[model samples]
Target: MDVTKKKVLNGYHVIFLVQNVMIGMSLLSLNNSLSAVGYSQWWFPILFGIIANITLIPMVWLSLQYKDDDLFDIHEKLLGKWIGKFLNTFLIIYAVVLFSAIIQHYLDLIQISVLPERKITGHLILFILLTVFIVKGGIKSLARFCILTFFLMGWIVYFLRWGIMYGEVSHLLPLFNFSSSEFWEAFRNGYNSMIGYEFLMFFFPYIIHPQKAFKHASIGIWITILFYLSVTIVGAMYFSEWQLENLFFPILKLFQAVDLTFVERIDTFGITIWVFLILTTAGAYLWMAKKGIDSVREKNSNYHIYAVAIFTYIIINLPFTQVMKETLYEKDFYVSYGLILWPTVLCIVHLVRWKKKEVV
Candidate 1:
């Protein structure tokens, strides 16, 4: 498919696309991720938002330089075909690993919290089928799904009010109490929640108003930041420092603060609805991996989507030990950090190439 000819997503699509992707699985465990900084973790989301916005500059700048090409195609254009394709292989691998890791994490959560009695095979098959169906519709379809999920899941944040009303205001005090090294560790660990925006590099070509993409994406990032801030602040207020550090999924506990007579287990409901966010996140990555394959093969085919899905299933099902699997999905975030910083490298290359052409 000619992605250049399919630039159908508008500013609104860009806004929700960035927001929904960044608000996925990580949010459930985010308080624990930032526990290195203690209760002051409430403000870390703003810092992350700033960092994300700053990094977005080079990504948007590089994307604007090649309005008709994605990061994969731009790689081939700026670097030589051989070197670009070599890098593209790694990009494809990153996308596939991320896609599988996301699904694996979500499935494990569901089995533990939502369906403890059921085996995960059925859930995995169903989730993959839904993800494939969504991705088959392409980026525009994915954008629409994102918009839908944003509205559907966004209201869940309001439920945090219950936690806020009951929480101790004192817990939010003692700001900046963490050591610099501890703050750095919190930044690194919590950054996983911010991973989804870098995906804009792959889908930049599909955005209808590429010129305004930076503005739209920044808006999306701030919106997510506000949502995260509310949760983190509420978590700080509601949970003791020890609880914040020990709880595997603090958001679930936050949901338990809602004492509605009509609903018995709001955390279960919250987690079940959370599948929508997971689908959008995983679907976007799956689409990105498919595009990477398209770039590698020099053709777009539905089979590439299925191929990626199959590969993801095989990877998730591999007989690795639990520790190894956890390391692959949870501990190994260097690749994501590298991708976020990669745009600066490309921008430097672009400037050098421009200078050489002008001199010639």
Candidate 2:
């Protein structure tokens, strides 16, 4: 594929791509994670958005330094062939695992709520196939799909009105009562919900207007932060502290509070519509993993996408206990945190080298 032709993402695509990827399965459990801070946890999303934007600085700076290169190219430039290739391999695996974990979480929900008797393998195969199809269309297709995804499921916010109406307003009054330790604990727990934006490094080269990409991406982050804040506030207000801590999917409970004349299973409907968001998230990561493969090979091909989809499917269906799956899922956050911060180190190294050359 021609490199120039492949760079198809515009500013709006950049905006929605970040937004859709960030709003994934993690939102269902985010309030539970933030329960450590009590009512004040509503502010965590804002804090997270601010922090995400700040970290995005080095990522954007690094990408702009080499406008035609992705993260892998920048890694190789900064660290040379052997070491950069090794680290890129680690990143590819990380992307694959991240994809598998998202698919695994959603499939688990399907088994528990939608199909108790069906084999998880069946669902896993179907979902991975769909992901592969989306990725086959390339990142531009995925970005356009994200625009559709934003509209398809964005109405979910209106459902929060029920939760807000039923919830105790007094619970929201004490905004900053939590101790620093408690706030840190909550931030640690819920920060994973904000991990998807770190992908900006890989996709930056695809943006048509690289200079304005940061503003578009920032809009996406704050948009997601608003959604997270709305849901977290509603969850904090409606659920007791114990309930907020114990409930696995607080968003589902919020939907349950919706009393619709025609639909008794609105929560199920919400879960169904949520598949769009899941596909958008997993598709982006899967695409990134494929791109990593191309980076390693120095060629662009869709075959790697299929191979990765198959690998991820097998990993998802491995005969591991639920405990093991959850453990693996939890471990991805550590990798994500490291990946988000790694570009800062790269940016510093690049600057030091530039200064040394100037001095010489």
Q: Highest TM-score: give the candidate number.
A: 1
TM-score of each: 0.98, 0.97
Pairs in clash, predicted candidate 1: none
Candidate 1: residue 294 Cα off by (Å)? 0.3
lDDT tens per residue, model 1, 144-232: 99999988888888889898899999988888999999999999889988999998988898888999999999999999999889989
Least lDDT summed over 10 consecutive residues: which range in candidate 2? 1-10
Clash tally, candidates in order = 0, 0
State model 1's lDDT. Answer: 0.91
Report every candidate's CA lDDT: 0.91, 0.88
